[model samples]
Target: MPSSRSAPVARVSQETCNPAVCAPIAEDDKRALVDAVETFIFDCDGVIWKGDSLIEGVPETIAMLRDMGKRLIFVTNNSTKSRAGYLKKFLDLGLEITADEVFSSSFAAAAYLDSIDFPRDKKVYVVGETGILGASSSSHWPPYDRELDGVGIQHLGGESDGDKKVTLASGQLMEHDPDVAAVIVGFDRNVNYYKIQYATLCIRENPGCKFIATNMDAVTHLTDAQEWAGNGSMVGAIKGSTKREPFVVGKPAPFMLDYIANKFGIKKNQICMVGDRLDTDIMFGIDGGLRTLLVLSGVTSETELQSESNSIHPDHYTSKLADLLTVKK
Candidate 1:
């Protein structure tokens, strides 16, 4: 297995903007910026909306861009919802978006599997919700019990009590199934000891089993609060247990851009990624060779951009996506 440390980091051009100082999107530059890009990739959560409410002026701005014949793509690192689920939110927010226009880390994960020709006969042991596997709600493991820590079904070749039995929620003693050929980790709100244990076992016990994660977002920006336990938190646990890293298929990794470019036949230089987060959204654009625009309406703040420790930067920054409204094509 390849070492995670050896994984290649995406390279940007030497002219890439300095991480410590981002240029403000001046009024004069807005028009040029708009004209230079053929497609706009938006980060949904903090840029277009916060929590359940749509961000102010997003609807009009999107419509205006669409009327201008510019392609629009919504890409999000949040794997909690599937693409179909996300489309419902867009419509509910009064945005006229189709299923193809929306892309989430969940869809990227599936696309990655398809690209690699993942075997149809093998099942994936998902440590997440329906977003990752598109399984029915009932197919998910029951709400995990905290008290079940360290209690796990034995792996193949592992010694167990002579009874060769493991008790389940239904009070039935069963043996472990070894059919799982991959372990997919994503955002699971009901995450507990069992899910982690099972995922770890699948990767460690199953030979040549793939390890995939939707995204490694450390925090999710929510209305009134920031949730620190994102999918990265869950993936970290599995990594620590198995000492094997997952092939993260979301932003900053290039899989999402690869999918969009292949499907739409859009050139990377003609795309602009607009989002609030520096790590996922902005970095994704930079990594993919697309122009990047940072908006202050989301996770990243102007103050944070000035920090010397900040390593990723967008080509331009604005107070909000509404700023684009001032730019005429």
Candidate 2:
């Protein structure tokens, strides 16, 4: 794998403010930053919908952008939902989107491993749900003859898991597959002492192996509740135990941005990241050299914007996506 030590940190600022925001920006800046951007990456949950409900005006805004010949992709740090699941939700909500147009942290993680020429046929130990690692084929794991042959672990239960039988399956997987090459964690609801203990031991014994996560989001919302933990929490526990940091590949990561850039044949400067969370959405824009717009409707509240961290800052702020049409173009 490539040295992630050189990956640019995620931060946000007004580096790409529209020329209209000040004295006329140079034509090149406008062309590079605005006119050339034919693609827009939107963060799900906060930007488009909260849970299953669509934020007001999102559909119209998306439709307008689509009609204008702008390419759109929903980029999410949430790995709890698979591409098919996301596509189904979007369709259920009357939004026009396809699985191919959506990219998740899971996808980026796999791509990152692939970019560095990681062997394609190696076995991997996955500690998350199927959504994060249950693909027919993945770039993260070396290509092997077996499909899902490697040990699979689920750390926690989902919204319906409480009513189901099993919980804390990840610990069991660890017990079953101690010799796996890599360990991965995504979103789990049954995270407990056993899973953490097992994961810690695995990493401690295998320092040379890889540790990957689907995202860093700290919380997720269900129809009736908002009890969740971000992947960072897991990272923290492992780091605290092993004194080692794992490689993260998700939203705001250059790999995902690079993937989008290559997929659409668009320049990084021309892309706009529209998201509600400053850390993932806005920070991605800053680090990727793209435009950032913070929405008032998501996880990051206006009050949190007063903090000193540049990760929470955005190039532009708005209460809703509809406001973009009114941007002084």
Local accuracy of candidate 2 as per-residue lDDT tens digits, 1-329: 11221122223223433322322223343333334457888988778888778888888778877876788998887765566656667888999886678787765655666666555444455555555554435322232111132223222222222233325455553343445455666666555555556566667775466777766666665442574667777666667777876777786667788877887788765677888877777887778877667788877765566544433556566777765543223
Which candidate leads the pack in TM-score? 1
Q: Please, what is the TM-score per model? A: 0.82, 0.74
**Across residues 1-329, which tens digit of lDDT does each residue of candidate 1 receive?**
11221122223232335544656777756776777779999999889998888888999899899989999999988776667677778888899988779888877777777778777666667676655545324322222110011122112211112122334677653334577777778877777766667777788888998888888988776443655668888889999999998999888788889999999999787788999888888888877888888899877888887688887877778889998998755
- Residue pair clashes in candidate 1: none
Off by over 4 Å in 2: 1-36, 135-179, 222-227, 306-311, 325-329
Give the CA lDDT, 0 to 100, for residue 80 in model 1: 65
Clashing pairs in 2: 37-270, 120-142, 120-143, 121-142, 121-143, 156-189, 156-190, 157-190, 217-230, 218-230
TM-score, prediction 2: 0.74
Our tally of clashes for model 1 stands at 0
RMSD of model 2 against the true structure: 7.8
Error of 1 at 235 (Å): 0.1
